[model samples]
Target: MHQILLIRHGEAAKSPTDADPGLTPLGQRQAETLADDLDRQFPGGEGVRLVSSPKTRARQTAIPVAGRWQARVDEQHNVIEIPSPEGMPLAERGQWIRTLLKSRWDTLSPAQGNWREDITDYLLQLASTRDEGRFHTTLVFCHFMVINSVVAAIRNDLQVVQFYPDYASQTHLAIDDGKLHLVQLGQETNIGSLIQ
Candidate 1:
């Protein structure tokens, strides 16, 4: 079984002006909490592999957990940030994201550039290594769209779902014989689902 864990970046600066924003103070706390939780949930001897998106926020979130797990993060392009909208006023960034999300551009054909080829290439690499039995667990630090893209790819559907995981929230899944399975979502508070 290819056990995969999906972790969203922590709370980021709420600025539409900056091309890429870092995590907020609260976000840092969230990452720390996540790290502690991981330490409790899975000890260092579990043979887990940790990876993160190349974005600053995502990478930051992965650091603490990776350190605890004694795992160096392998960046996956498939787990990068979502595609941003075209030129828009900075003040409208939040609202514009809501608008775009409502439309749900779920699956993009490889021919149309809707999907980044680099991400796909990396994903193929991941698939190829699924059965090697090198590790029992894997963590992926990624953004909302990238997470949703993984879901879309796993389900083989195009209907997009808007997912807003709290800062440093996690969603767990597993892959076996080239199939993805949802384990738990961090959004469920009683069960630590929406771990914001």
Candidate 2:
């Protein structure tokens, strides 16, 4: 059996100055807390592999956990977030995001190419890796839409895949006999637990 843990990146800053905006202060703390919880759950980190989307928030979230597990983090472009073009007013941006949820297009090509290809390809790669017995446990840090897309593909449940989870939330699944058995979805990570 291969276990896959899907994680949403921690909170991002309000205004994205950089090409890929990183996690905010609260987001960083959230990542740290999640990392601690992960360590508690998987003590030795044996048979574990870490993979992340290339965005700053996802990369940042994976780095600490990967380091703690003494594992190298691999970036898979196919796991990246859906692309929204730059330079839009706040209200328009908000509307744009909503349209994105409805699977509306920013451009015919970017929406069709990146989102569709990434989701399908990533799932196929993950399934192949699982079949090869490369790792018993795998952690994937990616955006909400991308993560849900892959999960939806695995379970053949398109409706549930569109629902986005909160920051730092997790979903767990076990693939046994080449089928996905969902253990949990939308497991919230409490940053307050860490502070306490």
Candidate 3:
């Protein structure tokens, strides 16, 4: 079995108009704190493969840890944040997400539904890659919805919002027999107004 670490990116430094936001100062601090904690929790991070979403915030979050281990971050766009709807203004994206949270994933439009499928499939493929029939661990720094998509797939949950993972939260999972199992969910913070 391969153990996967799904790390949500730290808070972003962007307003409602930003289509792509980098990490905020506070967010950078959070990532630093996460680096220290990762040393304590996982120790050395020696053999773990590093993967990151192709987003500014996620790449920023992955950097310190990758640097500490002298590892490279494998950026793949499939792990990116949820795609906004056609012509949806960046300013309205949060509200759109909030609304989506209350809805069901299976009811989305073809394009959106395909996006969700693609993300989940991407993660599953990552989990199944092993060396010499041995399981390996992968650390993925990604967006909130990308994390949720995998969680939902594992739990058979159709609802969009399975849980709210805090900034820098790390969720653990194991893949065995072509199935994904949630070993542990990440820490959840009450950031009701910080949904973006």
Best by TM-score: 3
122-166 in candidate 1: lDDT tens per residue? 544554554476777777787766666666556665655435555
The backbone clash count of each candidate, in order, is 6, 0, 0
Question: Model 1 clash pairs?
Answer: 186-193, 186-194, 187-193, 187-194, 188-193, 188-194
Winner by lDDT between candidate 2 and candidate 1: 2
Q: Candidate 3 — which residues are off by over 4 angstroms?
A: 129-135
Give the range of the ten consecutive residues with the poorest summed lDDT in model 1. 187-196
TM-score of 1: 0.78
TM-score for candidate 3, residues paired by index = 0.92
lDDT against the true structure, per candidate, is 0.66, 0.70, 0.83
lDDT tens string, model 2, 79-127? 7876556556444554555555555233345554567566655544566
The lDDT leader among the candidates is 3
User: What range of 10 consecutive residues in model 2 has the weakest lDDT sum?
Assistant: 187-196
lDDT: worst 10-residue window of model 3: 126-135
The local lDDT score (0 to 100) that residue 34 gets in candidate 1 is 88
TM-score against native, each model: 0.78, 0.77, 0.92
